[model samples]
Target: MPDPTPETSAGRSLLLVLHDVAPHTWPDYQPFVEAVDALGNIPITWLVVPDFHKRDSLAFAPGLRSMLDRRLQRGDELVLHGYYHADDSPPPRSVRDYFMRRIYTHEGEFYSLDQGVALERLHAGITLFQRFDWPLAGFVAPAWLMSEGTRQALRSLPLKYTSDPQYLYQLPQFTPISAPGLVCSARSAWRRGLSRLACELQAARLSQAPVIRLGLHPVDMRHGFTRRYWMCTLQQLLAQGRTPMTKSAWLSTRQAG
Candidate 1:
């Protein structure tokens, strides 16, 4: 599909996303939230994992839920990330699968799921949101990985949108907005250095795109270097005339177009 034109004449739209948000990770996530809040509470799309690693579930995290509710009240968006943000399938067989499993650290929940399994998990996530009466913007698979079967299942579900590494997709109509994400990898010093450089290059390359997505993980904020890198990237983007936007608002603009 052709890339959508920039919505505003002044600058490109920026979508800030926080991924893998759950109770267990809240301690690590708090600093990022506070930092953003200090920056005028920029609109963030929180990709909340309903059941993180099958170890921490939202039902057991009242305090965290309350905090998230406060953020929602303050205009942050909440979206279903995955039912269990863990890889429970068999070991990877192909080279691509191996890279995803090994390099990505085994968090591809929807990578190998069939249509039925994907739909079942989707419904489970939806039910959890309904139980809390929280507004779910959409579903984003862990590590932005989804199988063909999972994609097929998503087509039949009542979701507003979903995103991959390179694009944000509005459901039903499936209009894609090209917005490559810049994320940090802080697993090790070597990885962090590489990620920093990669993210910088990515930001520079995608600076002129209609929409720019900056994805944040709790781990990314855990390291001093990565955290600094993220701040610098954010400031650079802002200086380039990018305006912060929520995922829902971005989608709405696309739908209106």
Candidate 2:
């Protein structure tokens, strides 16, 4: 594959995404959002779950709605993450499937969903987003895991884009924009160590890429070490000439140019 690195600062960008945003997770985001705001004017792309884990729905959270409205006004983009954000599929047929879907991530709502089910969830999420009058440009499957059926279902929508850890896909058309994501894991001590080291190395490796993606979760924000690492990483990226923007804003610029 050809490198998507650019030669000048004009084409460089840093896409900051906050994942697993729901009513219950909103509180954890406050401090992190403030910290990023203090750094500079950075627009966040929030992946909002309509009904997180099938337990809590956004319909009951007026405070979260208001806060999200404010975020939109501040240039942040709201994206439909998933309906339930949990894997309720039939048990995996293989051990590999079990580990990848159940063990590696229990939040793979769209991971194994068929086209019909994927469409149902996407529409359900869209309806909920419409209820709040939130504008959506993309739908990121939970844990960045989208089954092939999910891919097909997304084609039926008018969304602008969707992204996994690797390539950012232009919606409907599916033209891929090569932008590898830098993510952190705050699950356990060993996981944190490995994830931090991986992110550090990936950042160094993608030093000149046209776009650098930073995927942050609510748990990551709550952790002291992960929080500091993200803040410091952003500072370094900006110092090196990357302008921070929401994922949608970045796409607009890239497409416009």
Candidate 3:
């Protein structure tokens, strides 16, 4: 379980992360999950949003919980995404906050939260998962936008790890594992086209990294181009000798080294 060094040629680890899993989005996400499962032996990390957009909650969705339970039994990892994956705070104060709030899909739940609000949401999310008796592996803020206060709050949370777009961080130690992710933008034709190209380029560039992440959203599966690109990207990675693993497993292996 030694760390994957720069010269290690055994194979690169690829992490397939599905973001924004919730009762409302499960219908759209089900097929994507099946498609990835069909690949066989690939471990997926499902980022579950306990209260998505302040609407859907897992307590009321038995079917969704059942599906997630089955996934866990099948060796997939479940991690906290966000409590209410929607931004309800006051308007942004700084320029960075404005762009993050307005441009990052207006659902940056942890982007502007103070330590207290972030901790409150974190507790709520963890409680929901505890009710289901699901083992929590990590926390990933919505859109990977965590405020400085939220990041500080995470330091004290009893989670194994947390991630942003660029790195998977081992908690307490905060040792970063470089794992750049490639995600699609499927909101519009223009964005989809750009995202497809970006994903292709990023995959090629990060293929040599120790860990490469493929981030999928429910909306990405709805678009033909994005869906095809995702499949193609997976195939390309596999062809290059990348093996799929759960995020938690990857971190554990690295840490145990």
lDDT of 2 by residue, 14-50 (tens): 9888999999898888887888899878888999998
Clash totals, every prediction: 0, 0, 0
Q: What TM-score does candidate 2 reach? A: 0.94
Off by over 4 Å in 3: 1-10
The lDDT per prediction is 0.84, 0.87, 0.84
Q: Residue 213, candidate 2: how far off, in angstroms?
A: 0.7
The global Cα lDDT (0 to 1) of model 2 is: 0.87
Estimate the TM-score of every prediction. 0.92, 0.94, 0.93
- The residue pairs that clash in candidate 1, if any, are none
Residues 1-257 of candidate 1: C-alpha lDDT, one tens digit per residue: 55643454434788888889998788987876787778775888899998898889999999999998888898889999988999898889999889988886689999999999999999999999999989886899998889988888889988988888887787755567666788777889999999988987887777678788888888887888888787777777777877788899877766576
Best by lDDT: 2
The local lDDT score (0 to 100) that residue 177 gets in candidate 3 is 68
Report residue 95 deviation for candidate 3 (angstroms).
3.2
